[model samples]
Target: MNQDIELLAAYWTIAGDIYPMGPTEVSPFSFENRMEAAGQAGFKGIGLVHNGMMDTVDKIGYPAMTAILEKNGIKHVELEFLVDWYLSGERRRQSDKVRQELLEAAEALGARSIKIGPGIGQEIADVKLMAKEFRLLCQQAAEVGTNVVLEIMPFSNVRNIETALAIVERADQPNGGLLLDIWHLERGGIKFSEISKIPARFIKSIELNDAHKYAIEPLWMDTIHKRVLPGDGTFDVPAFIKAVQAAGYEGPWGLEVLSDTHRKLPLEQMANRAYESTISQFRK
Candidate 1:
């Protein structure tokens, strides 16, 4: 049922993008406020940034967050992006530990998938090496009953759908799949045809964030710093959604807007605007 409907919500990271005026992304918003606002805004659910539940996930742990979500009727947390990709040595060990934490969070919070970026930079120069690395990640993810959603970010080595899919194919595990972000789609210059041709099996999870034209800089800065609402800019997002449907994707199509401008208003207003804009785009 990827096609026959519409679902949307404003990401807290967008709140992070906009900061203070956005969605109380840092401190003061509080869990009570966030859930209350989201419930009132007519959203299906939220795509949580793990850090948002810092008090619960970090301090009190997963079950507390799950109880909170269950108590509020917010059972659809789609993606959990674990952002500590570039760690090595003790930090690498910590990465695995943190990953376990995420899985626990998922089981506790009812998260469907966990997003994983395989670090950054030139280490991915060799395709085979990254593929093996991905397999290891998948094995770990499977243990926690969470599929590892491999995010193909512009700044990372597998910056496009093709490369990410290739790595997934080589990794040869059921738990490994693609997480498509539109900013990555355009920045990586991944063609629509390529996106359409991706096998149904590869795209386990997906994300929708939009962008305005960029002046060109490092890929790292672009993925986070320059994203807009899905339909507000030039991403051909509806067509992209159609491509996902055309390829048989049946997963959450969550909005991940990162506009610095949009966050100035109340988050409920922002969420409504994002939800309405995205729903309108898919109307055709």
Candidate 2:
């Protein structure tokens, strides 16, 4: 089963020594090291955050980064977490700047997709406006020969499949789709059966991770510091995987563990555990 499926090491999973929301979000490890660890752990692809990508591109350039990826047998690269896309004023301007950088990186790296989402802890009053803005983003991504995948979070305005699907339906772009994370879906209280109802084309990607059945208070804390390996927590990882597969999702499964404990492990150990634990779910 592991041989048949490709696993992607999401940025947070192997992001060495980075504070997620702190002033500095760059990983201390070199890009080559991260790729090497993931590749050695049997991952076919890897993810990078915006700041990390910028730092690497500035330090060694895209050609060097590309060479390292080729050296590691990484076929798929996922770039992520673009927010403030649907807003206006200074925020929208800043969002546009980041969006351009991500698109450029995606085109240069031949990345599989760029992950985006609505703002966390904020709700948009108009879904149609969000759709309009998302359509533009998708069009830009398509021009670069990549797709834009939307991740739904409980803290975001579009928290459930129903709302997420509505936005994607309205956007109506083939490359504009949903990123269904097992942690988010389960934490948000969305049913596994809801995934069965989504059209395959709309299910662009999926993430794997597990957590306690009940989230800790101030949910964001739990997501960042309490996530466990795929089968280590109470999540029904197998069922979620089955639902996504049933919906015809054929892309790599993103392993996005963000626990404090996971981050403390040695690079090789973290990568190994992430790959081995998630792959075991498929065998089950």
Candidate 3:
């Protein structure tokens, strides 16, 4: 694969979301199968959710799981979906357990980052306290040779690029940074002009997905099941790409389409479409 396309990643959702019922009557393929399809489609990296990674390890052993990725020529691995780190008491404790396991898994797999967010509600906590908690998480991640990237969701505490940047700056950990997902970027009303203001060092990762210019009713549902492939919707993907590139953020661009429609496709078709659609944006 060429260097540019080699920087493209296929996220786990491109395979399936690990639903018990599967993405469709025929889907929800195994982790090994997903990796092989993604590799064959020219993706150099693959994303894994925390629970999915643990389940795969339980089934195949960590060594075998990593071996599958290696055989597929997958170089970058990302673990995701850590939540409630900003809460206290039982919630924080529960988050800690999952966080620890994900950290260890990331270390084991030499993952690029652990994707985390405040989840689907508005957070009213003190920004400083949030930064402190994030700093602690970054320290833990640092010890394991991984990065902790805060994903900004429209309904979450870190709801915009400005807020996400504030938390990252206050945390002041080298490994603590922001994960910019294009769907969330548009949903949060952040313009590409604003994205250009961020330094490349603080932009830890970039995930690509497309959605309508106007939000659908009950936003979360659309986010989970309706995201379109790059260039298939109203998002100004080429502008977004140009803005990030202008900011000097040179990293793997992750294809993170979480649509029910996408999941229903056969693995090879899904992977190929994701790779082609994403690469088409860069071509523009």
| RMSD each, Å | 3.5, 1.0, 2.6
Q: CA shift at 3, candidate 3, in angstroms? A: 3.2
Instruction: Kindly give the number of clashing pairs for every candidate.
Output: 1, 0, 0
Using lDDT, give the best candidate's number: 2
Better candidate by lDDT, 1 or 2: 2
Winner by TM-score: 2
Ranking by TM-score: 2, 3, 1
lDDT of each: 0.66, 0.90, 0.81
Candidate 1: where are CA atoms >4 Å away? 1-10, 13-27, 58-61, 83-88
Per-candidate TM-score against the hidden true structure: 0.84, 0.98, 0.93
- What pairs collide in candidate 2? none
- Model 2 misplaced stretches (Cα beyond 4 Å): none
Q: Residue by residue across 1-284, what tens digits does model 3's lDDT show?
A: 23564544545456564332244322357888988888898889888776667777788887898899899999998888788888899988999999999998998898989988865577654678889999999999999999999888887777877778888898999998988888988987888899877778899988898986677778887787788899989999989888888888877888888786877788789888888888878888
Better of 2 and 3 by lDDT: 2
